[model samples]
Target: MKYPLFITQHGELKRESNSLVFSGELIKKAIPLAQISEIHCLARVSLTSGAIDILSEKSIPVHFYTTKGDYKGSFINDASPRGKLHLKQAEHYLNPEKRAYIAQQMVQGIQNNMAFTLSRWGINPVKLNSISVEGSSMEELMGIEAQLWNLYYAYFGEVLGVKDFKRTRRPPEDEINALISYGNGVVYGLALSSVLKAGLDPSIGFLHEPSEKRYSLALDIADVFKPLYVFSTIKALIKNKVMKRSDFSRNKNSVYLSREGKRKFLEALTDTLRRTVYYKPWRRSMSYRFMMDYEARRLVRHLKGKSKYKAFKPWWR
Candidate 1:
């Protein structure tokens, strides 16, 4: 099965025959092109022109992150563009009522998954009774989302026994925040891959305003899955004490996962993505990774007027 290729070492990637080869100071490895779903460079990794050619030809994205795991950008090859579908997607964004509906559903999905996840962890989530989207402005909806996440963070810290588990970014202040930042970056890349697969313009978003500097649509979609994927991975790691103190490094007040810590987190996340859960629509088990793609397709169907868009909740829900 194709899996995301994570380059954690400073290396140079080159195309050797039909495979991609990574050569570093102490290590060299060749990977079959077909086995890679996407490429993520968490370290300084340079891609040769030939490697770029094949990757673009294969329509695979290469995401880059800083040493602190902050997303820099991506090299995306849009090999296929659905012109009509894109126009429809833009229409949803342009129409205030339609944009409000999609944004509300996305937030609702985040709230439901947060509650369900907390309950599964033996914590009672705070009820969000005040979040009604009807006749609500975009700012109000965004404020509600902020409120929900703040509650989630409180519960998350409480359950994990992390003192003051506040959310921080741009070099997270605490260990929990560090893990969250890194994990969210990974999920953002995955969400972008899903969006591209559905042929949707990643820059056109409903919840987050579209900006030329970032793919805001991926950010919108990533929020829905972060509670399920990123938080769960952090919880498991902390609960089992899988990460060691050496797995982290500190630079003044900012904390970051060491290279070892990143590998551990990625391994656990890969397993989580591979684990199958029953999908009600298909009546069969599907991987979380597959579900991400399906979630994007659901939006496409909604835009095409084939069906109404509802954010993905757990099958049990």
Candidate 2:
């Protein structure tokens, strides 16, 4: 099975015949080009021009990050298509009908995600009086989202390992929040890589409007998968003592992932996605990457009118 390549070492990447090699101080090896979905160069990493050419030919984007774990910029050889897609999104946003359609899709995606998560714990969330999907329009969907947020937090104290972890929104003010956010970022990167491979326009999304530097569709899709991918991983990691309170930093204002914490968190999340899990919607088992790619393909179908787009429903059986 293919894997997302995380190049954490400071090195220069080169495209050798049929494979890619990373060589520099403290790093030397050939990466399997076929298996790499995306190349995440964390901290200081250099890439040769040949490596860029190979990755561009495969439509693989190299994501760069600063030493502080902040995102730098994505390297892609082509820019025209992304530019045109951005224009399309601006036009859609200007039209009321198109904007409404996109808003509905985003809400549907989040709603489906919440419903699926609740069902896993044998809870019928759709029947909850606290949660009501009133009205039929996009505006009403926001109301549904607010209700789901309440319901989601209510279950935090009940979920296995997290029962003891306090629930807080915004920056999560606690150790648990830091772990969750770190894991969520990993899942987002994984989903983004899959979306790129599917040839979908990540910048033109159904839920998130076009932005100057953000990929909104990736964020939308990541929302549906985060509870499944990130939350699940955190549960396992905490249960197994793979993470500790030292993995985070907190001030009165906010809590955040430490550098070492993020490294371990991403490592755990990557392993979780690599492990095959049975998905009820698909019947047969599939990897997390395959599920992400499938969702991207579904979006393309929605665009082509080949099939109606159904936001991914998290499965539990």
Candidate 3:
């Protein structure tokens, strides 16, 4: 099965015939192009032109992240372009009522997933029920979403036994914040891959307004799944006492995961995505990764008026 390839060491990626090889100081590995769903470079990895050509030919996306785990950008090959679907997607964005509906649904999904996850963690998030999704304007809707997340963060910190936890970004102020920032970036990259596979413009989003060099639609979709995948992984790691203090490093006031830390986290995250769960629409089990792609396709169907779009709400295991 194809899986995401993560490069955590500084290396050079070269195309060796039909396979891609990573050459670093202490490690050398070759991966068949057929076995990779996506590539994420979390370190300073240089790609050869030949490698780029093959990846483009295969329509494989390569996501780049800074040393601090901030999403820099992505190299995506637009192999399939559905012009008609693009028009329908833009039409939905152009219509205020349609845009509002989609945005509300996305927020509702985020809320539901957040509450469900919290409950599973033995934290009853009754406060999320008080927040209303029937906001008339985009600002009001966004405000409600922000409020929900704030409450979530508070509960998340409490359950994790992290005192006075606050969400900080860029240069994360604490270890948990660093993990959240990095995990969210990974989720966003996965969502962007799904949007590209669905042939949708990632920049055009319903909840998040389109901005330069930003895949806002992926951000909107990623929000729904963050609680399910990202936070869940973190919780498991903490509960199992798998992550050590040495896994993190501090530079002045900022804290970030060390190289070993990323490897451990990514391993856990991959397992989370790979686990199969029952999907009601399909009436069968599906991986979390597949569910993300399916969610994007469902949005496309909604844009084409073939069906009403519903955000994914997994059956908690």
Candidate 4:
């Protein structure tokens, strides 16, 4: 199976035949086109237009992130040029009723996944009952999700061996918050690549209103997987002693991971993607990465009216 390629160093990516060659101070490596399903640049990385052409031709999306693992944007070659799928997607967004339904589904998915995570860690997810998606307004849904996540994250502090923690951003105030900020970026890159594979217009979304250079569809998808893929992985890493406080560096109030810390997180993320889980409908196991692309295709079917949209829920072991 093909895997997403992540470059965590300051490197130059160039095209070499049907492959990508990376030249950097510490490492010079070549990656065949077939082995790379997607690409994520985690730090200062440069790519030539020739390399971009190759990736575009292959329909592979490349996501760019800051050295701090904040999402910058993505290079997704527009392969779906105002086709039938795009029309349906636009129609759904334009119709307030349809848009509201999808928004509800997205929030429901996120809340359900959060509850599942808490349950798996032996916490009572019943606290999520305080929030609901019964209203029409997007504000209600967003508010409900926020409240539910507050409870969910409260449990995360216990599972990850942290205390009295609150999720913060904009130069994360603490190490835990810094890790979450970084991990969310990881999941967003995965979501965008999946959207590209499904030929969906990431800008036109069901939940978030489309904004300049913001892939709102990816934002919607990332919400569902964050609890399962990103947060779960972080919890396991810290709880199992794979990562420790020394991995992070704090300058004043700004908390960030060092290069070695970044490498360890990426390696753990790779393992999380490769790990298999039972897919209830298929009754077979698939990797987390494959499931993400499959979910994107499922969304396309839902938009086409061929099937109803269903959120991905963890079938815990």
The whole-model lDDT of each prediction reads: 0.85, 0.67, 0.86, 0.82
Which ten-residue region of model 1 has the weakest summed lDDT? 126-135
Q: Write the per-residue lDDT of candidate 3 for residues 1-317, one digit (tens) a residue.
A: 46778788899988887787899768989967786888888889888998898888888889898876768888878888789888888999999999998998899889988988898888878888778786557889889889999999999999999887899987888878878888998889888888888999888999999998678999998998999889989998888888888999999888899888988888888888887877676788888777788889989989988999875676756
- The local lDDT score (0 to 100) that residue 168 gets in candidate 3 is 91
Q: Which portions of model 4 show Cα errors greater than 4 Å? A: 129-137, 280-284
Which of 2 and 4 is ahead in TM-score? 4
Q: What is the TM-score of each candidate against the true structure?
A: 0.90, 0.79, 0.92, 0.90
What's the residue-level lDDT of 129 in candidate 4?
A: 53
State residue 274's C-alpha deviation in candidate 1, in Å.
Answer: 1.8
* Candidate 2: tens digits of C-alpha lDDT, residues 1-317: 56677665667888787677888677689887778768777646787888887888876788887644445777875533544445554566577666566566656666666666556656677444344343346566656656665666566445653454556656667777766655565556766766676666677665555687767778767776776677667767776888667777877867787766776777877787787768666677777767777887776665555776665655545
**Model 2: ten consecutive residues of lowest lDDT:** 126-135
Per-candidate clashes come to 0, 0, 0, 0
* Total clashes for model 3: 0
Candidate 2 lDDT score relative to the true structure: 0.67
Error of 4 at 7 (Å): 0.9
lDDT tens string, model 1, 1-317? 46677788899988998777899767999977786778888889998998898889998889888876667888888888689998999999999989999998898888877887888899866554345545667889899989989989988988998777788888688788889989998898888888887999898989989888778999999999998889888998888889998988999999999999998998888877777777666778877777778889999999999999986778663
After superposition on all C-alphas, the RMSD of every candidate to the true structure, in Å, is 2.3, 3.8, 2.0, 2.3
Question: How good is model 1 by TM-score?
Answer: 0.90
Displacement of residue 296 (Cα, Å) in model 3 is: 1.3
List model 4 lDDT by residue over 6-41, tens digit each: 888888888877677888769989977786788899
